[model samples]
Target: MERLQKILAGAGVASRRKCEELIQSGRVQVNGETVTELGTKADPAADVITVDGKTVGAQKKMYIVFNKPKGVITSASDPQGRKIVTDYLKGINERLYPVGRLDYDTEGLLLLTNDGEFAHLLTHPKHHVAKTYLATVKGVPHGTALDKLKNGIMLEDGMTAPAEVEYYDIDPEEKHATISITIYEGRNRQVRRMFEAIQHPVTKLKRISFGDLYLGNLKRGLYRHLTKEEVEGLIKLARTAGKPGNRPTPKKDK
Candidate 1:
């Protein structure tokens, strides 16, 4: 048995939080009776659940790794008709939510899944699932600025957690540089903001990896389902974060 919200989210009805709202609003019924309590649980297989009188059936969980191209919205839908990440997921029927968001102008490894539990586990702040990005900045960051990024930067929200930062390439003539940074926190436009704070705004950015999962060779706008082993490995990585020896220095992407 699982929580009713979990069942609804796993069935692709909506996110877990939205499903909980649906339950609280008296839209969900279990075994032909309305279930408005937040603590309600039911066996998904045996219980006939409905939302707005429509039956909710279990859906096969899907885990996909998408190489998100720039200029696409990270959301499942866009009102202004802008292309969204889901639009690139051609022929896949499952309603998969992005595990976390990448900026509309940012590109690279993006995880999508119908499994709410897995998505939550990976995205929770305490999990510290490291995400690595390669950013092309307007100016080459000097050692002092890089060190400040490696330590922490005070943002409007608060002092950001320490990040792993290293410069990969420097073009003196263009005054541009490419840097690889790994961060544990999932703040909005964090990488871009970090550089902006250092007075070297990012010109381009691409996420190269999330935890142990790498974007590797996957062309932009293409996607592939995660192998069982890969999915399991991500779960283990998130679950074991903060334990002794679990925090290793992030490797720079070649």
Candidate 2:
């Protein structure tokens, strides 16, 4: 299910914000019941939605979980015509776009959806929906350095919000450390930048999870439709994030 304004907006009835105004003014109805609340959710395909006595056309909301391969730009299109994420979604009929983005050379879990509200909620910093990444770095940062990273780091942009940063594995012989990082903000190259500020550069990076979505056994360059339960799990998280005084906390490992 999706927001009523999104349904009406997708049907070419009006802009999404205008649809909300229509809902507040009692000009919209769902299955014969007037819905004036802005947060009310409904499935456009299952419900008979109307705006100002006009029927809103049916549109299916689509979601995809993709193991984005390296060297693909996470965007709808690239000006230089380089390979893009949509190239991997060739057969998809819906105009699904990436929820946030992964850098061109970064790989791992990425979400694609046609729902604007869902995308906005997930990516917005105020919502504080955390995204996770696994990074291989050169040196093992210990003691106060780890504490500095966990509390907050001073990047060129400014001080970042506190992150759940830890070393899941460290190979002293190989001089390589595998770090698991959970961050609430989506700053540009924030993960790599965080490590850099601590004097441990990120060698390779992959997003392992976004909100409740995980990569699991999905291999690289692969894509799949999110299961019903997975979708509902995200919706529930969004509801919680919407509450006043909701703050981003370090999520416990599952």
Candidate 3:
């Protein structure tokens, strides 16, 4: 028997942490009895598990790489009726949610999948999966500003970890520059905020790569299934990086 949250996560209900919240909130029922204990375990094959009165079982896992267009929400659905990432996936029958988030005004590579465990493994802060972004900012920052980003930046939340910054070309007339920044954290609007901290607010942003997956000319609003090798590689990377002593110390502002 496996933990109920694990079963629910494996069945695509939500991430393991979210599933725990559902259980504690009394939204999860097993064999017609409400269970609120985090330690509760059940045999998925034999037990009748229902979340919010809807039965859940093992589903055929699907992994997709999407090139999200700007102005599209990264959620499964939006109450405001704005366009969502799933709106691009018209024919896909499986219920998939984005593994992480991209801002509504930022476009780039995003992953959608029904495998909640996979989502948690990659997104949990301890994993430190690297994500690279190409940011076009308003002004050309000097070496000192770029060094601030490379070492760390103090944001609203706190001090950011050291990032990999690649200085690219600048448009002399436009007073703008395109720089590539890679970060391990998935904080909300992190890249944009990082540039803003350096007095170079991002005018445009696009995620170029996530871990082993590259966006590579995938047109905006289009998506494709992940190959077996790509999925395995990502899982291996996350697992390896999550091991003890593998995580990086968040750089303090000096």
Candidate 4:
């Protein structure tokens, strides 16, 4: 028997965490019985499971990389009537959700997948998946600003983890200078906040890479599935990081 949340996530029901919430809210039924427990288990090969009275089973897994455009929320829906990332995935039959998130104004590479276990591993704080971004700030930062970001900076939540920063020398004649930043943490508005702390507000931010994945020439709002090698490498990394018995934490929106 496996945890119900993991099974649901693997089955493309939702992320493991969100599945747990469904259970708690009395939306999930297992073997014809409502299961409201957080760590409930079920046999995927045998037991019948349902969410909101709909049968639940593993669906075809999909791994898509999207070059997200600015102004789209990284969510399945928005009650405020705003456009969400799902709007860009018009033809996909599988119900996939974004792995982590990009702020509404930020744009670039975003992963969408129905493989909840993989999503958990990629987004979990302990795994430390590095994300690289190209940022254009209002003013060019000096050595001190860069050093502060590398060491750590104080935020409202607490001190942030150290980040990797490098200047991007594009055209010297360009009005705005570009900088590359790599961070392991995924705190809300982290990249922007870090620069703001040093008096250099970010004008534009685009994530160029996430973990081993790169945004290779994909234009804005386009998406593609991850290559087999990339998927395997991610699986290996998750296993190496000790993801214990395939039991994933319940999914919550990041």
Candidate 5:
């Protein structure tokens, strides 16, 4: 049996994650019964599956990298009717969804795809691919502050994993700085909130890289298909990340 979302993704409905939303929203029917749980599964060969009353069929997978512009919602659609990431994908025929999300005001690299397994591989917790960002903040961080940020900062949600933080530029007045940070986790508003925890709220934030993929001169609000090499590199990185860690050390001598 295949997972409901996986089956939908392969049928070109959307990415696996987006398919989960369909399930949760009570729009997915399997053999004429609604399945709302994420773990629901069925044999696509036998089960008559439909999404929002439309039957699904095998479809080609698609991938692209979007240079998301500020003020656009990262979601496929917004209840408020604000422009969303999907609005920018007017010319693309296949249904695709953002791999992860960038905040409405945050600008930079965003990945979109209809490949469910590929999306799962990239966003899985064990495959927390490093993401690099450039952030303009309100104050220059002292060594102590920078150290705390690098080691880990305690946020209301939890302790952040270790990160790499450095000053990219500091104003002569020492009042503001452009900081570069690389982090593995992609919690909601994490970078902005991390700085806020350190008393240097971010004024501007832009992701420059995601694993092997780079924003690289893509004009704002425009997108491009990823090169074959870049896609291969991400698969390689995810494979490496998903490997089991070396077994725990043998019990030490007493």
Candidate 6:
């Protein structure tokens, strides 16, 4: 049994802190009785739960791969008044959120899901989920600059782990080069920052591949569910790279 508030929060009802307020305000009920207790527990699968008179049930777990278009925010909501990725998924019934994050200016493959455990597994750094990107930068980084990126660059938090970087193409006249970079670590704006460190700012960044998943032919703003094989591959990869004490045991999906 899990705390009622945590269940509600995990269902995207509200944050845990806000769920506490909702409970205290008598807006929550369990098994047809108003529950104002802060520490109320309920079996999400069996309990009759409601919030503000609307029945609350366990949401169906959904996993979707989206070919995210540029200029759309990855977040569910943006205070800065910008278009969000959720706006494109209007017909979808499930309330899904982007698994990790891709900046507004960056584009390409992104995963969206309501499975909190799966999201945690994919985003947690200890999993070492590899992300590959195709970046077009202002300058062609050669020799020493390439070495620095491949070896590792010192960031504000600490030194980044070694990355795989190779040139896709170079246009000397335009002073730009298309480079492929694969990173196992996810820090905030890491790909962009890595290029900036070498004085070769990235003009465009698109994640081409993530683990065993790829953008394929999915058009921008379109999404599709992962195949059974794809899901199994990801679970295996996560288990292999997950932290020593926190590795997730593979479970059969119903």
Lowest lDDT 10-residue stretch of candidate 1:
242-251
lDDT of 6 by residue, 21-109 (tens): 99999999998999999888999989989999999877766778998999999998999989998888867977778878999899988
lDDT, candidate 2, at 80: 97
C-alpha RMSD between model 5 and the true structure? 7.9
Query: Cα deviation in Å at residue 35, candidate 2?
Result: 21
lDDT tens per residue, model 2, 1-254:
98888777566454456568899999999999999999899987689988778887755777899999889999888999998888888788777778888998789999988765666667767777768888888888875887787788898889988877776778968588978888888899899888888888988888888887778888888899998898888877766664322233323334
- Cα deviation at 162, candidate 1, in Å, is 0.6
The candidate that wins on TM-score is 1
Best by lDDT: 1
- Candidate 4 lDDT over 1-254, as tens digits, reads 99998998899888888877888999999888999988888999899999989998768888999999999999999999998998999799888899999999999999999998889888888887778888888767787888899888999999988887767744465555577888878899999999899988889999888876778788899888898899888767655653222322211212
Q: How many backbone clashes does every candidate have?
A: 0, 0, 0, 5, 0, 0
Lowest summed lDDT over 10 consecutive residues: which window, candidate 6?
A: 244-253
Off by over 4 Å in 4: 170-175, 239-254
Where model 2 places Cα greater than 4 Å from the true spot, the runs are 1-57, 242-254
lDDT of 1 at 252: 56
Which should have the higher lDDT, number 3 or number 6? 3
> What's the distance in Å from true for residue 19, model 6?
8.9
Candidate 4 lDDT trough over 10 residues, lowest sum: 244-253
- Candidate 1, residues 118-236: lDDT per residue as tens digits? 88889899999989898999978899999898889998888988888887778978689999888998999999999999999999999988988988888889999999999999999
lDDT of 3 by residue, 71-163 (tens): 999898899999999999979998899999999999989999988889999998888888888889997888889989888899999999888
Sorting all predicted structures by TM-score, with the top scorer first, yields: 1, 3, 4, 5, 6, 2
Q: How far off is residue 201 in model 3, in Å? A: 0.7
Mark the regions of model 5 whose C-alpha exceeds 4 Å error after superposition. 1-4, 15-48, 242-254
Q: Cα miss at 218, model 1 (Å)?
A: 0.3
